[model samples]
Target chain A: MSPVHLEAVCKLYRGRQQLSWRRLLRPQPPDPPHIALQDISINLPKGNVLGIVGRNGAGKSTLLKIVAGTLAPTSGLVQVAQPVAAILELGSGFHPELTGWDNALLGLALLGLDAGASQQALSDIADFAQLGSAMERPIKTYSTGMVVRLAFAVTTCLHPEVLILDEALSVGDGAFARRSFERIMQFRRDGATILFCSHSLYHIEALADRVIWLDGGRIVADGAPQHVLRDYQHFLDQAPETQTPALPQAGLARGHAALEQHRIPARLRRIRVNGQPAGQAVELTCLQSTLRIEVDFTSDPSLPAPGVGFIITTPDGRSITSTSTIADGIVIGRDVHGSGTVILEFPDLPLLRGLYVLAVYLLSEDGLLVYEELPQAAELQVHSPGPELGYVLLPRRWLPLGNGHAAPDCKPSAHRYIRT
Target chain B: MRGVLLLLRRLIRAYGQGFYQPWQLALRHRHLLRQLLGRDAIIQTAGTHLGRLWLLLGPGLQILAWWFVFDAVLRVRPMARFSFLDYFLPSVLPWLLVQETLSRCLSLLREVRSLYERSIFPLAILPLLPLLLVWMIYTPLEAAVVAILHGPQAALAATGFMVVLAWLLLPWCYIFSLLGIFFPDGAYGMRFLLTLLFYFTPILYAPQMLPENLQDILAWNPMATLLQQLHGLIGLAALDLHHAWYPLACSLLVTGPAWVLFRRMSIQIREAL
Candidate 1:
């Protein structure tokens, strides 16, 4: 039997509506409830790792709550074969006034362990958390990462049949995270069913066997991680446009033929790279190398010297950078009227290895009016030799410091691992 | 009798599960409960030098204040048989227990909210924590006071009534806790109401001091019955069976429905948090 099974589950929360003083004498109608999850069904066999991916308020946490049995669904059946543990939030079940040791025992008791068993489990959690004397102190004094360590240790050591982690490992040091991942792997080896949710696609890709993508309280896609993630990425790329309409076909030639035929104002006709028409894939050669993008478009005759620009953004529509003809302080002469090409080039791009989307736009010469915009006009995949953190990579020179003094032979492995 | 047996069986089968599961969980995790209670006990008196002695000090001060107001200032005679101090002590002890439990009961939702959501632990037993903590602080002081003034018999009577009182208050505690979640202002409202109740009940004066109609009205008030019971136990008043019956019947009626409703309502109320 599957460790967790949810059928036609839905969750509705009543909005906390305030009634005015004038309505005190009258019975106020109850506020409509917000639908957090809408008729969602899921089944997880033992040993399967299911990842939930969604934007904020997409009901990912609500789904995890239902699976963990912490929440009863509005109108459906939830069946779980084994004991479930959910790390919904760090320091959630802890009392601030109580020491970590005391809280740990309470947490275990909540999980249905006897007093002797909970006491026995204490040493294991203490050792695993490596909190040392901090376990003796009240939980309010402990840092967030320490609390997470203690929480993670308690939950993992309990040997739950079904484990649900909802962005629980987002905090904590790298060593603790590594230990947590190893423990999860060990749980998987023991045929435990796991539900993992996070905003980080990297963790999802590494851990999840199946992926469910939620959008506005409904499942948009669910399948193998690779297939569902690709569809989810595409959705994020053009989320505003529900469906991708066909782009108008244009001439193959470059000069007057391609320009004059495209009389439409501020429409992106074609994109080129190094004097060649860039097709299907655009790879950003990321060895601190320069990359150039040429956007060919048409502008109306009346709007002279139209501003052509391109914006580079992440898949989630966060704009990283944008440049326009007005911003660059370049004005076209009166003779150039019908159509033109705007060239945007990056010299030694500092962006780390990741997927990025480029959006091209046409604006009035002053650059205030956006005449047209083509979001996700091009996709750039950066490849790098080393796994780097964040968007940009910084240049560095290694001058080893030995014993608080600059020395040639010594290395900074200890300092470097702290970041990883 | 058969019909009543069936109903009792059904009640046990249905509400008993809700009742037993949390208690069982509490027993299983008694170590945790001890830790939690111990932590709460220490923290209550941590900043003060006298630690835990404040339990006695607080009630002692209240007794003194009441004595000063009724005896010295007003020169009022509440009872002919007993001094005002002796008359006020036993009634006030139980009154304080009820008052403290009611005040804490109103905020049970807020306290449980902090701990329940962090894990999948059954939080059904959490509401009882405050009551137990309050009992832990007051029980010892109560024993000492009863033993000192009224002797061993009074101490035993007070302890016996306290157990009965806890059972009487449990259902209302759960009901108020659930209400506290919906109305965060319920705590303040209860404080206001309990203060009015203290005056209406015969804590500061004897019921005989009032007119017959007022005495008739006060007899129906549950606190009045409880205080009368304490007075009877301490040899201050006769053990009036009718007064005792009123509170017993009222609590039984309230507890039966409250327990069932609390079991059902708590499931949904948790989601609100």
Candidate 2:
């Protein structure tokens, strides 16, 4: 049997509609129940990783909650293998006033660990969270990152049969993120079924074997990660820009509290593309126009300058080309006050036709934690003439054909592709 | 005979199906229950220098305040052989159990909804939380007080009666918890109602102190039946068989329906939240 099987699962939120006494005394029609999920079905075999991706309120968290047995579905069947541990919300199931050690025991018990196994799990959590003596202190005193670390540790330490994470993979960066990434990888190696949801398509594509894209509480795409993610991005691209801009990844706001104790990390102050404002769309000739992106940032004088990245992607959210300050070994010089603006210039851009999106990201001093993302910073509309179909036009050298003799109109240059 | 046989069959069937679910969930999550209760015990007395002693001491202070009003200031005494504090002590001990459990039940589900409802802790087990916590705190205190005042025999009797009283209050735990969740107004109203109930019962004054009609009306109170059972068992009041039927009948009448109501409202509670 598949480790996780869901059949025709539907969740309708009929919240307190006719429950009001005032409504009962003088009755009016109740509002329609919100359909959080509809006709969802999946059969995930053991050791498989399934990724859920969707827009905000697209019911990603709702689906995870149901499968994890937190919320029962309104109708239909949900059969998940037992020993399912889920990190639905950060620091959930943890009492703030209780010591982290006590909370871990409680969390393990809720996840169905008995007395014998709890001791080992508790030790593992203490080690994984690296809180050390902080484990003896109440959770209220720990920073948010420490809480997430503890929650993540307790949830994953048991090697649950089905591991569920909702926007939790962005646990903190540097050693802990890498440690968490390795632990999740270990869960996969140990044949644990992982159900992961995230706004980062990069992580989803790298980690998920199969992906399900939810739209309007229904499964719009489900298949191989690349195929489904492409389809979802295309769907989003075709959609009008009427909806509000999506919220940045939730982890972007994390670590600020801890950082406050030390120094302010780098943040995107301003950006300009080819002398145009970052908000407006800029047109560029495929090979004739130079794509110049200038970025300004400010950070604490004591801290080193933060790294910056420039990414260009298709309208369907697929990255075609990327570069960064750290990758090129370029150290941004800081002024006396540790604030500076640096310009990145690319002469004669070779991007092909069609509309594209570019985003500038700011990383911490360690260059592992992505502190902020200026998503959709600008639209780069590349104009390429002739019949070229794809993201980039690679430079080519056509060797002499027919002993260096070539026709004038259909010359050796005729076979040579002109990008502009 | 037919009705008795029918009750037997229903009891057996309930035992087979939904009746034991709460118990099973309790056993399944027993460790979590221990941790939660332990945490509550610590938090209740943490900031105080006295620590866990405040479990008994805090309630002791409240009773001291009452003693100043009724015994010292008002100079009230029961017509019975025992002093007013002696008359008040045994009954108030049981009343403390009811007050603590019922009052906490008003916010029990609300407080732990996020902690348990969204996770594996069965929501059905929530109503039992207040009962168990209060029972652990007050049951021994009642027996200790009885032993100190009366004798060993009455203390033993108080222990047995408190256990029985705890069982009888189980259904009300579920009932009040549901009421609190569905109607928040019930929580505010229940506090005032409990205070009125304290005065209405014979815990503070003798029944003869009130008019005969008021005494007649107070006898109809279901809580009075519980208090009467406590007094009779400990050899303070006459062991009246008239109030005996209510405790047993309330348990049998309400246990099944309360469980059903809890199960029925589980979905609604999640949505409402």
Candidate 3:
């Protein structure tokens, strides 16, 4: 049986309303609930390591808390076959006034160990905590690392069947962090299930067999670690900078059309490639790979084979390349109207690792006037891991300049691609 | 009738399991309970200059203050057949024990909310541990004091009364613990009510000091019954078995609802925290 199962879990947090005398005297409708998780279902079998990755406020922590049984979902069924031990937050409940020894014993008790079992486990916990005589000193006297050590030791020593961790390993120095990972690995070997949530993709990549990516309180993607991580990386690549255009006050109606112009065209919506939602950024694993861009749009019925054009430019507005259907001499034989989609295929595409802006234009069939021009429609990010750095990869070869020694053993070599 | 029978079966199963499972866990994990209690005791006394002696000194001072206020300042009569010190000491000690247990159990779920956030365990015993800790510290010392003042028989009887007092206080403590989690002002309300309860109880003065009608109503107070029974046990008042059995029955009856409330609120407490 699966060690953990969550079905149709939804958590709604009611906002705390400000209490007033009048409000107290008269009953008022409660504040609307904030949707923390919506229709989340998961099943984690024993020994499976599930990594949760998401931007802040993505409900990763909420999901972990639900599994840990600290927070009950508003509506759902949760079943866990074995006892759960969690380190949901670092230094979560460790009392500052209590000594390390006392805190460990208390933690053990809270974890369901009786006094004698906690005492028996105390020595192992001490050895793991490595606080030495400092174990007797209050936790407030210990450093942050010491506190983490004590928490980690007490939690891991219990050998819980299902462990849920929420960014708990982010602290601690190098060696200690590695040792903690080793301990988690040992738990994995012992067939214990783990739910690990972290912002660190490297840890998730190294540790998780499966990954779930959450966005806006919903699981947007869930699958193999590499696939989900790649998709998330693509989202991050196109994510807007910290500075966003501030909205004007309601009273300031003037110049609102200028802001309206900044918004992407409603007619041309949704971009994807190879069955993956590309959004404003597309991720490619190889430098020279087939690049397909599918654009779903509402077309004007009167326009017959209206031309489409796109321009690629550097982040600072230097145009690198531009293409147009009119220039390419590709004829759209039939007139299209209403909802239509255009597929732009670029085989063996060449691009460099850097942020590039993509601007798209819709033109009249004659290509004389611009029907719609969207500037900086998307930001294209090309990132391929390698030591080589340049604007594009080229098929250049060295022939020993002056034909020295006849370029011994000149033969085609097997190509290797970097897998990062 | 079938539905009622099913409901009854369910209630019995739920309440029975709730009651038995915690004690079963407590027995199995007696070490954990002991360690937790020991930690509380250590933290209480470790930093103070008085140290472990504060276990007695703290309550001893309170007893002395009561003795001074009533016996010396007020020049109060015993009202019972025995002396004021003999009558009040045995009864007042247990009274204070129950009072502290209830008050301490109040806001206990919130105090341990952060701990529960970290791990899962049989949470029903949270209020029980503090009571046990208080009992572990004061009962033996107070029992010895009773032996010195009275005799071995009285001490044994006092010990038995202490056990009974713990049993009587358990369900109420659990009830208030859940209340403290749900209501932010519950602890303060409980404190105010307990102060009122302390006065209504026949702690400072004997039941004979009250008017005849008032004594009859006060007889219904469980604390008063327990105190009167304790006084009986120690030879300070009349030994009537009804006083003991009636209150025990009432307390036991209250446990059914308290246990149901506990089971219901257990889920909510996690949410509230």
Candidate 4:
């Protein structure tokens, strides 16, 4: 039998509306309701680990609570083949006044153990909690971390058939987290079906066999970990970034055409990568061409040899390229203004489709750092070329093996490709 | 009926595992329940200087206040056949026991809501703890009161018969304990309803004080009937077999329904908590 089967489940929350005296005089219909889950169906087999990921308020917690039997669905059925245990919230069943040992017994009792069995389980939980003499003291006196430790110990001792953990691992220190990770692995190895919810992508990637992405209280995507994570990341990227003021006239033309069409007022407009806008100044995309980066800066005549530097990095903080005016042999001291437009043109962007942040540095003539922007201004996303593979594409030439290859006459091409 | 009997037997087995043999579970978890009760007592007595003394003192004051209200303020006549204190003590002590046990059982779950969340603690034990505490403290106090008001005869009668009756009906305490966990508001509402029940019962007044029709209705009050039987045993009133049988039968009738409700609700109480 499957560990869990949820069929045609739907949860609806009724919204309350305040009625005025005048409105109350007449009959009024109920306010519209919010649907937390709609016709959701899921089947989890034994020994499988499923990770649920979603933005805040996406009903992931609700789904877990339903499966834990902490909540009953408004409609439909949830069938479980075995006894299920959930760490829905930390310290949920522990009595603040109870000692750690007492709580361990209580935990076992809740699992349907007899008194003798519960007593036997207490020692194991006590050992795991490692509170020593403090286990005899009231739990209310314990620190938050201590409470979490005790709760975790008691839960892990249950040897539950199906373990559902909702963000429980995010608690505790580094060492405890490592130990907990080991314990989760052990539980998995023992063939316990585990459902984990976490915002940590790394943990999900490492621990989960499958991932379900929830959006607007609905399952937007569900599949293998990598596939679902990719979809979720894309969903996050497309979500509206910070609302910005309108853009300036020349700035509007240089900005992405998508930005130019946005109804934002000229002054309020700001550049955004995913959902967050650039902190510094805005960099404009070339009009009608997406090939390279172009910077337009107003130069101050007082500052000489004003050097400009541009650094591009992937969203995960991998440095793609860093170039400065000095490296390009542009002497800012000789220029009339301390600052001038420094354009770094790459005829072919080497970066694969991914989100990238740009950083710009403005320097004085004597190579004194005047102003530096680590990820200078805003974020940019290079959209995925459908079905493209490889982290980067390199421009290379192949010549015939023999040295006597005929020389071919060629015209000066407008495009130039560089390989590093 | 057979299925119910089987389920009852199972429940009894489950409960028996924890009942008298505290060491079976308590040896390991003695620290746990102790800490829970200690913490509860501490928080309950925080602002008060006397601390746990308040547990004894609060009930003491309640008994004193009730004595003053009934003996002094109303100056109501006692039952035609007995001393005022004798008539009042037996009835008041059992009434106090019933109220304390039932009220505590009802709110037991709400008082331990946090403990319920910690998945490790079984919620069933929550209701039991309060009742257990009440039994420990109030049982002795009730005996002391009986001995004081009516001397050795009343004390011996209560110790033998009334005490046994209370123990036999102790299962009611467990039933109410489960009810308390299942419906927190239900406890408060029942407490309020018990105020009306107190007047209907012959706690402060003689049963014959009312009209015959009213006497018949008041005679049907289960707690009153139990009190009458208790008073009769203590030599404060005549033993009315007619009144005695009704309460015993009613108590029996209540047991099945209470057990069913308790078992059914016990499964859901943890979820509610």
Clashing pairs in 2: none
Could you give candidate 1's per-residue lDDT for residues B1-273 as a string of tens digits?
999999999776655554455457567667667766765666666657897777668768877898899888987666897777778777787788888887877877676676666456555566666777777656666667788878888898888888788767776777777767766655567789899999989988898899887888886689888888888887777777666888877766666566667667665667767
The superposed Cα distance between candidate 2 and the true structure at residue A342, in angstroms, equals 15
Q: Per-residue lDDT tens digits of candidate 4, residues A1-420?
A: 698889999977655433345456886876788788888888998998999999888888888877887666778889875577788877776666566776666666556666677778788777766778998887888998788878787677767788888886434542354355567668889999989888766468767889988877788888999999888766765666432322222231222232234311111113332234445333332121244444444333433435666667655544567777776787643234222344456543555556666755544333323332334455655544334454444444555547878544322121332213
Candidate 1 structure quality by residue, lDDT tens digits, A1-420: 688888998888876543334456686777789999998989888889999998889999989988887777888889987788787886677777678888788777667777778878999999988899999998889888888889888777788798888985433643355457667777878888889898757468767899999988899898999888878776666666332322324333344443445333444567775454644346764555566888766655565667777767766655567787887988754335556777778876666678877766666565544555566556778766556677665555557566676543422222332334
**A1-420, model 3: which lDDT tens digit per residue?**
699899999988876544445567897887787899999889987899999998889999889888987777889899986678787766666777788888887787767776667789999988876778999888989988889888888878878799888886433543355457668777888988999898767568867889999988899999999999999877865766332212211221112242244321123444555455533565554355566766555444443556677776776545567787887887544334344567787665566677766666655454534445566555667665555565555555555657474444422221434443
Candidate 2 lDDT tens digits, A327-377: 788888988766777788877787878888888887655454565677777
- The lDDT for every candidate, in the order shown, is 0.72, 0.79, 0.72, 0.64
User: What ranges in model 1 sit over 4 Å off?
Assistant: A17-23, A240-420, B1-32, B42-46, B72-77, B185-187
Could you report the DockQ of all the candidates, in the order they appear?
0.37, 0.48, 0.32, 0.20
TM-score of chain B of each: 0.86, 0.89, 0.91, 0.78
Reference-based lDDT, residue A104, model 2? 91
Worst 10 residues of 2 chain A by lDDT: A247-256
Candidate 1 accuracy as lDDT: 0.72
Which candidate leads the pack in TM-score? Answer: 2
TM-score of every candidate's chain A: 0.59, 0.68, 0.59, 0.58
Query: Between prediction 3 and prediction 4, which has the larger DockQ?
Result: 3
On TM-score, the stronger of 1 and 3 is: 1
Docking class of 2: acceptable
In model 3 chain B, where is the ten-residue run with the lowest total lDDT? B14-23
Error of 2 at A287 (Å): 3.6
Models 1 onward score TM values of: 0.72, 0.80, 0.71, 0.61
